[model samples]
Target: MVFRHENIRITIIAALYFAVAIAEVMCELYAYKPLIYVFKPLMPAMLMVLYFNTSRKRSALFFIVMTLSLITNVLFIPDSQDLLFYGLVVFLAHRILLLYYIIRLLKINDYIPAIIATIPFLLVYFYLFMITNGIPENSFVVLIFQNILISFICGIAFSHYVMQDSRRNSWLLQCGILFGALHFIVFVEKFYLTGFSPTIFRPMAMGLNAFAFYTFYEFVMATEKSHRDDARSIA
Candidate 1:
């Protein structure tokens, strides 16, 4: 009965996650500004719930990350430059914490692979940099810093996955990082670049963000399971 109850809980959470994700996308597509405000923050809130429900062992670091993410979402809702800069600052701290967490699990003996993995991200950053014009100076600085940080995260995640290709947790972390980087790129193009259509890129960014958070949650669960297996083998 405990097992059954757990399964039921997971099912409900999964259903709600999908529903919230779809509503978020629809709000973007239809230009429902009011509903967008309602659903945007809910995205991270649902992720928090999903993590709480599915994780066998929860870490305070993960909860802190999700809470900051929620705050970032709220900060970005306004169309003011001051709020956007503040949002970027909060997000920078969020990424720094995430970087610390990922570094704790680093097992790479060689840095060559990680350096090579960063090339793609560098190229993307270059493209975005060349195309972006008329953005506020402060926002531009923060955006560049954020992109560089994300590139490092993606490179480290890729190298980690290469080292442990057979591990599901490694793959989950890799996907989550890649999805997050892509979402950030799309967001920049839609909001900062000229001649970009929000109708197309907005929903795309939102969907990618949703998937990234979901995979991050999965990565946490998979990592816990991997640790358990290692402990069992040692015993």
Candidate 2:
């Protein structure tokens, strides 16, 4: 019975991580993009965040994926090739930037991390929207705002889930999902507005959702810890 429970737990975690990625990929294949498709990875990439192992591993894997994703993206949609390169560079910079935010998160409150981590993305998107591309109707800002909240909430949920059993993977995944969801929201808006079809957005989202595996894992751990603490108090 115990073995069965463990296996079931594992399956549930894996499934949560996988679902977002698969959904985004399917969306891309079926939907593609009508205008600027910055939101290519719509759902799939969210799941991928859970798969990253350690710091070194995460950096290396991220670099490789960013490179490959950029390459594939350029070949598939050659128009935004230069922009994609720039985007990847910016993403690389985020690794360092994330270090700064993580420090802030741990030092301050949990919510601070999300704001510090995601605000830059919003700023960048705003610049790209208004300056690079003419700003959309201010009314559209509401849509963007909602997306930001979605990403932030998703990050919190993912982070909480990852705290369970992911070890280092949990912390890293939490950060990834937090930022990934925010980015996804931006790219999707780009797609809707411009018609530049970039698949990175969806993949990024999947990567974020992958942290769901870690989220549930963390929940279990917290529950166990609480029980143990109670038992200790009783003793």
Candidate 3:
């Protein structure tokens, strides 16, 4: 019965995600800003359901991060630069907490690949900053720092997967995080450098970003079950 209940929850979450993804594409193509804003936080709100089902140790942290993320997305709907900054600060806090959770849950024994992976991101940021001289100095600095934080989150995910092979779903979590980070940087650069509004692509990008959390949730559940099974075996 418990297993069936969990499956039902997962199915509902997946259906909501697919709905959000379709809505995102439609909004992007049709330039529906209002509808886009409406769907932006839908996935995070869905993940709030998963928060309750997960182990008690991490559920509160996960819920907090998702709540902050929902607020951050909503904040971006406004045109205020101050609002954008506040959103970024909230997002930064989310990442910091996520990093803390990842560290607590996964052993980090392999640092070389993670360090190597971050170099390319850093170099690319430098190259872009140097070549795009027209971008406002302030925007450039903020974008680069944002890129760094995203990169750190991706790197940590990758390292956690590589060093902890016992976790079955870590690779999925890693790929999801990496995709979200890279795509986010792409959109940010396009927005800041070329004067292109993200309306065309922000939906897909943000949808993908939200989906990563779902994958991470699955990873957490998988790991927890594995741990429990191991404990049963020992007993």
Candidate 4:
């Protein structure tokens, strides 16, 4: 019965996600601000409901990430540069926390995979840097910083996924990285590139965020099950 309830809850949350995605597209089309507020917080709120467990470190960290995301979203709704700057700082902090949490399970022995993962990061970074060299000083710095940070995260994610024996967490992490790439594209479009980025990318970026939360939940479950199995063996 609990399992059934969990599945039902997951289904409902997924449905809501799809609805929010539609609303996102419509909001872009119509320039609706209310829809932004309604859906911006829904992802994290539902993430907490789906993954919250007092005993799990990943759960708590993810909750913090999402809470910060919600706050940042609210701050971005205003036109003030100061508010946006503060939001970026919080967002960067969230990324650092997330990076720490994901890397916690990794060990020094994982260096091979980690090094291999950096190839793509270097490739993407050089390509973007070459193309956007003409951007303004302050904006260029922010764009470069964001790109580097995201690339580093993606590199770590890919490397960790490669070294996993079960491959379950690895695939989830990889998928999350894929979505993260989409979000990166959105960031580039919004900050560096000119012209209207299609509203369609909005939901695509959010979809990546949903994938990240789900990946964390799965990691927590995997860790808890391993602990339980270890306890049984000891008994």
| Candidate 1 per-residue lDDT over residues 115-205, each given as its tens digit | 7887798778767776767767787777777777787778777766766775654655666475656646555753555365556666777
Ranking by TM-score: 1, 3, 4, 2
RMSD of 1: 2.4
The TM-score, computed over Cα atoms with residue i paired to residue i, of candidate 3 is 0.78
| lDDT, candidate 3, 103-147, per-residue tens | 555555666776776666666655655666455444555666666
Best by TM-score: 1
Q: How well does model 2 score by local distance difference test?
A: 0.45
- Compared with the true structure, model 1 gives a TM-score of 0.88
Taken over the whole model, the C-alpha lDDT of each candidate is 0.75, 0.45, 0.64, 0.62
Arrange candidates, best lDDT first. Answer: 1, 3, 4, 2
Name the candidate that leads on lDDT.
1
Tell me the spans in candidate 1 whose CA falls farther than 4 Å from its real position.
Answer: 106-111, 167-170, 173-181, 190-196
Q: Please, what are the lDDT tens digits per residue for candidate 4 over residues 1-235?
A: 9878877877786666557655655664565778777766675676666565323444566678768767766665544556656766677676677667556544245556766776687677658666653344544556556566667667766666666656445654664476457646656555545355665665566555556556665665565566667779999
Instruction: Give the residue spans of candidate 4 off by over 4 A.
Output: 53-58, 76-82, 106-109, 133-143, 165-167, 227-235
Cα-based lDDT at residue 13, candidate 2 = 47
Scored by Cα lDDT, where does model 1 land? Answer: 0.75
Q: How do the predictions measure up, each by TM-score?
A: 0.88, 0.39, 0.78, 0.76
